[model samples]
Target: MHGWRIPASVWKWLILLMAGGLAVLVASELHVGLGARLPDGEGSLRVTLEDQLGARPQGLGTHWLTVAALDPRSPLAAAGVRPGERLRFDRPLDRWRRFAPGERVDVTLDSGRSLRLTALPTPVGLADRTDYIGRTLIVFPALLFTLAIGWHQPAQRAYRSLSMMFLAMSAAFFYSFWFGAADGPSALGKLVQLPLNCLAWYFAADFALHYAAQHTGHLRHWLAHAMRFYRPLALASAAYTAWFALGHEAPWLWVPSTLSIGGGALILFLSLVDGWRSGRGDLRQRYRWLVLGLMCGGVPPLLTMLPWLDWETGLGRITVLAYFGGQFLTYCLLGYAVMRYRVFDFYLAVNRVVVFGVVSLLLLCTFGMLQHWVAHHVSAGHSGFGWQLLSDAAPAVLVFLVFNKLHARVEHAVHAVVFRRWAAREAQLREWLAAIVHIRSSDTLVAGLAAALDRFGDHAGSAVYLRLPDGGFALAASATGRFPPRIGPNDPLAVLLRADLAPTRHQLPQDAGVLALPMCHRAQLHGIVLLGARPNGESWRPDEITLLADTASQAGLGLQALRVDELQQAVGSLHAQVRRRSVELQAAAGRRRFGMDALP
Candidate 1:
């Protein structure tokens, strides 16, 4: 693979592009207008009704079907008409005429039996298409929010979650458009489309709780525990949606949406309550602000369902808009938390941005291809600008996404390998400098240098040898800080070397190998330090030569102090011995004088 991949910035743009396309599709569908879309009914109770009255019928209320009259011989024949049941037709009759099938009549019959009927020619009324606007407004921004959150704080456990949540919203939008334009009577299609809104609702709640937790540290534990329950809740939501769509049960849809969103809100409430009860003032303050936002963002959608709201003139659409707005606002706060708190870090954010962007772009391109194929091949020459718009955007979006991923990966790799290693070495060198704080004598200097050498063990041993005035050198300290075998004038470079002389380095061979560094003090050469191969026979780094030279200079200054102390101690000892010898001679003289006087 080429080194350059995608970066996070590009990934975000990709999501935007996709969401924009989805929004466009939704807009186009809306512009087609409700009058041109909804099946014939102006204050008429004509729902496109189909009753496939099998023993176990599925997708019964999914699409628009003409309700046929009940067959008297059918099992549900005795029952009367029921709600959502209507008369059917065999073929396209005249405008506004009562629909009729040739031979068979199918009816709901108040007992919920179904039969096939003829198609009808009916005019479509104005459908309140305001819901499309809700989808459009939410889809792109939510996608951008999700991409942003995931890219910057991917490891925070919220990243995957929020991305999936927005993706679910996108999925819902796609289904809505697909169902809106479906040509045939599709029970399966409606069955599939029916649950998308509910699922999107669940994802919305999930994304919200996670995002809130990210901001309010007090809520994190509760949110984490709440997240653990998501799998079960998701399964339940799916099950409920299936039951509602397939079983034609209203309560099934109601149960999951209420339970999932309600449960999330309850969890938030408890977290807020606990935060308030805590005596810590700062904790209470931050949490209260957060809780306020959550309520504002979360509660309205559920409350809008009440009958006092007069929901028919597109209040359902308003509810969604409230939901999206609240979620988007929370997304902004969560991003602020990430930046202010450094919740995860830059790399994770970058990684997410790149991956999400590239994937989103690819998906957008794929959708464009599918749309083109459908428009050209399946639709058979019927053309629309929507397909053209999506296709034109595909190539640019793909290129932008791919480059973003590449940039992020390359930067992360280089930082890890090169920059971090260099930083570590520099830190070690600083530590060695700190060790030389209180140096009273040369021994301390030697010991410090030995410790530093241990850090570079690939080199076998180090030795410090001071030069004598006579031009010979004596070993002062070794890697062990012990005096080694003295090198008089017999060493390999003994003839070529000088001490107190030229400020230069010279290597000399002993019974072992030769690696030498010259010690210079104030531009004066003091001695040469030799380091032998390590016991493991490993080679030292080239930088070690410079490091050794620096250490030797410090060691040279220490050696001067040692030499002075040694000379002073030797002079004092000689004086004391002379005094004792003089005293002995005096005693001998006194005894000789006494002997001579006695003889006289």
Candidate 2:
């Protein structure tokens, strides 16, 4: 049993490289043109078509294009081919037909109008470019996050399931983008690639259920057993979809595929409910965000998949954009949970995300309003290249001028609201922290911490527990009569504080009112701080909790320094004793040699 591990930083770079290469390949395969419209000329016509044939003339097949718009100067316009008219070809209009520019073709309209014209090239439009770019944005981050999870915590079964789900979704995005970008249906691309794309979704659904179940620790045995049959069902559905895509009509495949997706969604919802009901504190909070993220990421895409929605049309394109945006938000939240909540100990990640989001929104809104005002007043009717350049550059300049100040104000506001107490007394807290670090004895360090806590707020009592060599927590300092003399290493409160280094409220034996804060450094439990109820007997506020945690961390550092100093002193004393012993032995040997000489 052998395995290899790669650092997360390296994994990130590799994922970026892979994404860049894939982007380049997809771009190369894409057909570039002036726009979605035909060339503006006498012979050329600008025609828009209804994407669905059912919305057009009854006799027209799905391949027949229904004209939604026609340019006045076009030859087709001269021939009285108007909007609401439908055009049909001798053969089915597929990707191959759509891309072959300048080919002469026979066309018949629904009104019995017929004309011979060269097929206009289907130019890629702004909407098309936006869709492809959006998908790329979504896929890149999602892939990076997935790889990071797998590389950083490969042993975690929940993360492995999540990685697989993300991988399948990424592959599906790639295939969809690849075929969608092609000028025509490259037979190999459409047949083989399309089915594989559809197959990816089934795999994604299965993995999503597995991920949720594993994460919530619910329905473990049943879900694991069900998974054995689910794999075969997923594969069969993919094969059936593939067969159906290859000119075979089978409606039955749709039933199982739909059921699979629906079931996965149900499983996830149930898991969330179970987790929310069974979990506490951070676990509960995590489940809430997971639900939100999944909904934001998954529901929009499902809505867009409604049969009546024509995804190639303008409205459909907007829906797709929304879907991609939702997916991006979803992935961001999920990544934050997995990285910050599950694996990493950094609490500031959430704060940073919030700050960044708020600042970005403010900047965007400000920039947009300024640009609009500038364009209206300064650049109206001045459509020269220089004027256009100035219009484009003004917002950026304005943003640069004000962004730093705005960012600072926004961050300050967020901290003030989120950590009100800490923000208010940060300077004082810093001064105390500095004084605590300079203390060189355990008793002094504990006494200083207790005094600092008292100065910070009105606590009924306070005590500091220093960790003994044998792993017990002994009360080194306390406010005259605040706490007991000692708490054993195996005490419930001691064990809980040691296991989770977060500051939490705990009742001592017989319901003693105390808040226990774990003093830890780099995840090693060093000691515990017990503080009695506030003077007014109020609940602990966020800022107060935050202050306690911060103080505990500082106290841990002070205790560590004290321990190091004690060890250094012991070593010096041992060295001195060894020197004295060496001198006494030398003197004794000299006396023995003198006595022997006298006897001779």
Candidate 3:
């Protein structure tokens, strides 16, 4: 409560400001680092990641790869080079991306002719720039996700912990790739890395604690205990880093780095595992991608950073790529998951993801084939750049023409296979909608309406309220006991429903987790359907809201029609009794005359 604290109202803005500052500093550092590594000599080498990994027609694992690309005028080429030849480097593919200009890289060819390949002392090469861009792309999106999720649910523990985790992770990755210094990792970056990683470690636990359906508490208590241990170490580490930066001989800070990487990663992984074990179906699904991300992103660092294992880069391109690949994929997937959490979950999140992906791939492949055909068959006579452009444009135009229908067909086909289990639930929902039309009884209509909503397993509870003779709506049927018994004519829910006859959102709130939709027919509010909270704590998706609204509309009409039918039957019965009474009276009139006559 003492040192410095921003008010809750402006906390999101504070985070944004911090992000901006960090981005500026990172950009400047990257620019300087890239400039420092600029090639200073005219010498050149044309090796890419694929070239360094080697060109093999067939083999397995590390045995399949490792070859150096040699430009005709380059030193490696001048020495000796041949087709289908292999070579080995001192470092893996990742390290190759960070090679400093004028650095002589030692290699051994398949022919046993060992040589040192002098990396051209020139500007940042295409491969290096590409690597930097790719890693940055991966980090920034995850970072942005943190801001997004936090902004939406600022009070939630998951948002704060998740945001901090990615922030630290992004910073750590920046240090990994850019290193800040041309010669090696910057002293400043190294100085901050320890504490940032430690912070990440603690936040990982914080996320674990809060990611459940219930949060630990509403306040930020993440650093309560961890800060006590982290502070003095941070001060000492800062002093040591400054000392080392001044060219003094200081002991390398392996202790803190090792502890942070190992401790933080383990804590994250174990927490996720614990949650998975404790949670149910959809809740468990939230952890799978995160655990995978951790496994893929965590293992390499543990194996590499720990003093015991002493992991090295000689484990082949595949291993190295997988290491980086894991981080990239993990972050990308999380970014997607966090950003689209509420907007895109129905059936199975993963299934829909696959459906979209497969459809997109099919479209791309077809378009590519069309382009290839046009390039080879239609572009033979094309000479000018404009003509070539026209040839390529033809395929694009054709693809665009067919894109919508083709995408729909492909998407539907993919969904049919991918979402086989969910398909039945969808069919059941449609069947429920259809079944409502024939429901003639008022009691049956409202009961059936509640059951229809209950069929889809999202809401915790559901209720159907029908308009009474006095103009108030009373709960006619409920799948669960959460809803109120009656909504009076002057009740806010009733007032709003009367005004608009539409669905209510969280704005005009009553009880928690309740979404009220009006059942309207001929512009009159016939009934109201209230759906309780989702069990997983997520908002109702668009498709779900659409389904509920459609159900409410049809149910309203059916209820209105049933009421009309009952009124018609009552009137018809009254008419039949009146006619029968009249007939009896006419017969009695003749009998009464006979009785009078008899009495005289």
Ranking by TM-score: 2, 3, 1
lDDT for 328 in candidate 2 is 75
Each candidate structure's TM-score, on Cα atoms with residue i matched to residue i, is 0.37, 0.56, 0.55
lDDT ranking, best first: 2, 3, 1
- lDDT against true structure, model 3: 0.58
lDDT of each: 0.48, 0.58, 0.58
The sequence of per-residue lDDT tens digits that candidate 3 reaches over residues 1-600 is: 011354545657766665555556566655555334322212235553232211221211232134435456666667776545776554422232344556677666778888887766555444444445445444554455445544544555555666666666666545444524333434344444435655666566556555663422322244334544644554455455344334333443445544544555655666677666665434555666567655766665444332344323433333344545676666545534433333212233443553365346446645754665566557655689887887679888988888888888877765565345345766787898788777778898788778767766454678988888889988889885477788787887788888987787644445623577889887888788888776766555455576778878987887888889999999999999999999999999999999999994
Going through the candidates in order, what is the number of backbone clashes in each? 29, 0, 5
> Per-residue lDDT tens digits of candidate 1, residues 265-286?
6765665555545523223444
- Stretches of candidate 3 above 4 Å error? 1-4, 17-137, 155-157, 172-198, 212-252, 270-296, 306-319, 332-439, 443-451, 458-561, 594-600
Best by TM-score: 2
Residue 530 CA error for candidate 2 (Å)? 5.9
What range of 10 consecutive residues in model 3 has the weakest lDDT sum? 52-61
